[model samples]
Target chain A: QQQVKQSPQSLIVQKGGIPIINCAYENTAFDYFPWYQQFPGKGPALLIAIRPDVSEKKEGRFTISFNKSAKQFSLHIMDSQPGDSATYFCAARSGTGNQFYFGTGTSLTVIP
Target chain B: NAGVTQTPKFRILKIGQSMTLQCTQDMNHNYMYWYRQDPGMGLKLIYYSVGAGITDKGEVPNGYNVSRSTTEDFPLRLELAAPSQTSVYFCASSYGNSYEQYFGPGTRLTVT
Candidate 1:
């Protein structure tokens, strides 16, 4: 079963526009939510993460908005750039904080 | 520091063949992980180790084996290659269970 479900398998946006990717989970035991970004032929790198204790977290142009009651989280890239084009993954950590469940992936493209 | 490094950037295996994917980290992390990423599918954990001499299976550990002999090395072994096993393998490490993970570029393997 898919523990984390992500929407909009692919996305296209203009430069400077905000591109958002959403993900939802059913397991309340998950406490840590992280976003990873992967460029072609490269490994997925940690983008930003949010714990259930907080409703939002931001780093640079990336922001993660989380809703604990809904068990949903989203990534918003402000001023999206072509260089930001890549595959994004949202993941949730098990209660033990050792194992993680990842969403399928979202390919985002920023057209200049 | 070379956070994480994986050997054999690309490889092709024939049915019934066997091979080992090498991984090394210079971060001296206590936690290491092996994951497989298929097209559009997010990363799936194959195996992980909390520390040297301690290892455990993850979501999809079948058809794969792993060992963490040193804090720097975590190798993944595949016996009897199958088409379904074709995917990009990634190695990651973190200081602790709650710390952010650093991922290697990845190893693209094709099993025919």
Candidate 2:
């Protein structure tokens, strides 16, 4: 099993449009969820994250909507701009802290 | 703070060659990790260290080795480089197991 699965391997959105990426996990033991954004020639950076106990988290134009009962989570980018075009990944960690599982990743393109 | 730093931004290795990818973090994080990112696949953990002198294998540790001699440095070694091992490597560190990880700029390696 993938452990964590992300949908829309690729996405395209116009400037000022909203781009949403969804992810699901099969492991209920997972308690922490994180999203990473990576640009060409660089490493991934933490965009946003959420815990199983929370329903949503918003940081600037980025938001994370989490549903523990459904074992799913999604990232929403409001006012998507060309600068937001990059590869995004969703990852999960079980228990307190050992290793984490990652999704396949989604490549997003924002057109001007 | 320099966050996390990785050396050898790019390298090309011949089959059977050995090389070391160096990583250092100024954050003094207790948790350090080495990950490899392939084209379509997401980042895969190669090895991790919870503290100095302690290291553990991750999902894809087959051809790699790691050492954590101090709280700030975690180096990954490739004993025998292979074409299959060609990919981008990332180093990350977290203050604790429950905190967000900070990543390095990443090292791109190509084995031929």
Clashes found in each candidate (C-alpha, N, C closer than 3 A): 0, 0
What is the C-alpha DockQ of each candidate? 0.76, 0.75
Residue A49 displacement in candidate 2 (angstroms): 0.7
- Which residue runs does candidate 1 get wrong by more than 4 Å? none
DockQ of 1: 0.76
Q: Candidate 1, after superposition: displacement of residue B43 in Å?
A: 0.7
Best by DockQ: 1
- Model 2 per-residue lDDT tens digits across residues A14-60: 99999999999988888889999999888889898898899999999
**Ten contiguous residues with the weakest lDDT in model 1 chain A:** A93-102
Predicted candidate 1 versus true structure: per-residue lDDT over A51-92, tens digit per residue: 988999999999999999998999999999999999999999
Pairs with backbone N, CA or C atoms under 3 Å apart (clashes), candidate 1 = none
Candidate 1 docking band? medium
Ten-residue region with minimum lDDT total, candidate 2 chain B: B94-103
RMSD of each: 0.8, 1.0
B-chain TM-scores per prediction:
0.97, 0.98
